[model samples]
Target: MAGAADAATTLVGRVLAGRSGALANRLDLAGIRTKPQDFAFLIGVLAVAVLAATLLLGAGWLSVIAAAASPVVAMLFLNIRIARRRDAFATQLDGTLQLLASSLRAGYSTMQALGSVAQQSEEPSASELARIVNEARIGRPVVAALEEAADRMASEDFHWTAQAIAINREVGGSLAETLDGVAHTIRERGQIRRQVKTLSSEGRLSAVILMALPFGVAGFLMIINPAYLAPLFASGLGIAMLAGGAVLMVVGGIWLYKTVEIKF
Candidate 1:
């Protein structure tokens, strides 16, 4: 039994190792410090636990579904974290750019200004800027590093900042003033984004409620009377109906999300 268990663990590790690089990048974006193998193992454990719980509840089919959904749920959580981190990074960009501009006005070089911002700012901004500084110190082109950071964070504002820096390097100009102008534009964009979010809050909330309603009803039914939802899991016809409803729900959810999402 011990040898069999060891073999199984090794097999799982090997299977998970194939995607570790991509998963590592995603985990880094999400600000999670976990190793990919460990995260994969945790997800496996969670799936087994969920499967066991469903089995204990006497829903074999539901157990299978739960097992299948566990990794997807974990990915959703990872994406949410990445999004929140990206938002925080974007929110800090205006102040960070202003500070960088101030440093430049104080006679600092571009790299020096970036290093100063890395020291003075908060996380995400600080970490990202520090990375750019480090990469530049190691002889990587600062513009390239900045562009990579922008891509990693998915920040248009940061991408524009990189462009500004690149252009400033190519020609002779007042870098400080250029950064100040960029900061002003970013500040204005932030204001507009907040206004849009405020205006669309109601619609986003409605979408959330609409998406959750079916799950909420199903849970309520499960508690009130387990048998009420049993056929949906037990009978082929009922299972098909449930699958169709789930597909429709997913499509509707995506439609609602796209409808409420305002891109600038």
Candidate 2:
């Protein structure tokens, strides 16, 4: 039974890593896995695929195989989604914060200000804020509603900002200035992050080209000289070498990620 379960886990991992397609995404949604889970699944798949290929190709061709591309593909997808989600939330918060501050300046109560903004804006931020306001209207504390919104997004920045508003409202403070400060800080942080990303663009491009070279060359070799490249896959030793190659690739990736992940 334990062996069977392990086999099933292996199969799912392979399928997820093999291709970035509609089916893979559907599987992800069905499993309710986050971006990290999706990327991890792809890495496992790449390992299995590499082992399979090592049995079919020569040891030298291990670096060039398409089966080893899963990690890069999965990481790219995850990073793109995360970056976009952050941008969307930041953009939405800019107008929402400004409006809320202006409403407070005009003498409206905090909840009323949120409700007014909710009426004019759309999801996911607008609907999110409106839900908080409505919850507060129905006898729920504004703090609870705001906390819920922060939890839903799973963002520390949003959670902290919401807590600031909730605390200020409960204790009585200059909310307009507080909110304006929050918005300005968020915008500035986003600008700085963009600048860092822009500066790192060259490094990112180099990583891509260096990573792709081995795989590209292998594919060309496979197409041009099948018999010559068969030694890697045609023997047990060659298969072992391929597995080792996969491990090295994963370690390299982890190292590169650590190097590039500079928190601004």
Candidate 3:
């Protein structure tokens, strides 16, 4: 039995290995330290639990749907975590640039200034800068390291900062001043982003409430009178209607999201 179980685990690991590399990169970006295989196992367990619960509720179709949706839900959660981490890194960019500029003005070389920031700054920022410093120490060009970091974080401000550094290296300019200018621009953009988020808050809230209403109503009905929602899960026509409603709701949610998301 032990050998069989070990063989099953190895089979599962092999099956997941191809996808695990990408998942591991995303988890790293999200600051999650779990091994990809472990994370995959946890998600599989959650999916199985959801499938079992739905089956226990006596809805075969619902169990199938739950099983199918579970992995998607896990991916969505991972994406949200990565996005939040990226946003946090972006939020810290201005301060990080300012500190780098200060370190430079104090006579540190570019790499040394970055190391200083890595030591002095807080979370995400410190770790990211530390990674760049480590890369530079290993003979990777500082500009390339910066560019890679920008790409990883998807931060335009950091990309511009990297550009400025690259240009400064090729030309003759005060690197400190260039960083200070980039910091100022990032600060202004941050302010604008916050204002936009504030203005769109109401619309975002409305979208959430709108998207959740049907599910909320269905759940309430289930609690008050389980039989009321029985036909929806039991009959083919009702199931088709439910699927259609779900697709439409997803489309409407995406439309609402696009409408409120302002690109500047």
- What is each predicted model's overall lDDT from 0 to 1? 0.92, 0.72, 0.88
In candidate 2, what are the lDDT values of residues 218-253, reduced to their tens digit? 789999997876787889998898889878877877
Give candidate 1 regions above 4 Å deviation: 1-13
TM-score to native of every candidate shown: 0.91, 0.64, 0.91
lDDT of 1 at 119: 98
lDDT tens readout by residue for model 3, 34-128: 87776776777788899999899877766988888888998899899889888889888888898999999999999999999999998788988
Residue clash pairs of candidate 2: 55-233, 56-233, 57-232, 57-233, 58-232, 64-214, 64-215
Runs of candidate 3 with Cα error greater than 4 angstroms are 1-9, 53-61
Positional deviation of residue 9's Cα in model 3 after best superposition, in angstroms: 4.8
lDDT: the better of candidates 2 and 3: 3
1 or 2, greater by TM-score: 1
Which tens-of-lDDT digit does each residue in 1-264 have in candidate 1? 778656666776799777789999999999899877778877888999999999999876769989999999999999999999999999999999989999999999999999998999998999999999999999999999999999999999999999999999999699989989999999998899899999999999999999999999999999999998888877899989988998999899999999999999
The residue ranges of model 2 lying beyond 4 angstroms of the native Cα positions read 1-83, 134-139
Clashing pairs for model 3 are: none
Clash totals for all candidate models: 0, 7, 0
- Which candidate number has the best lDDT? 1
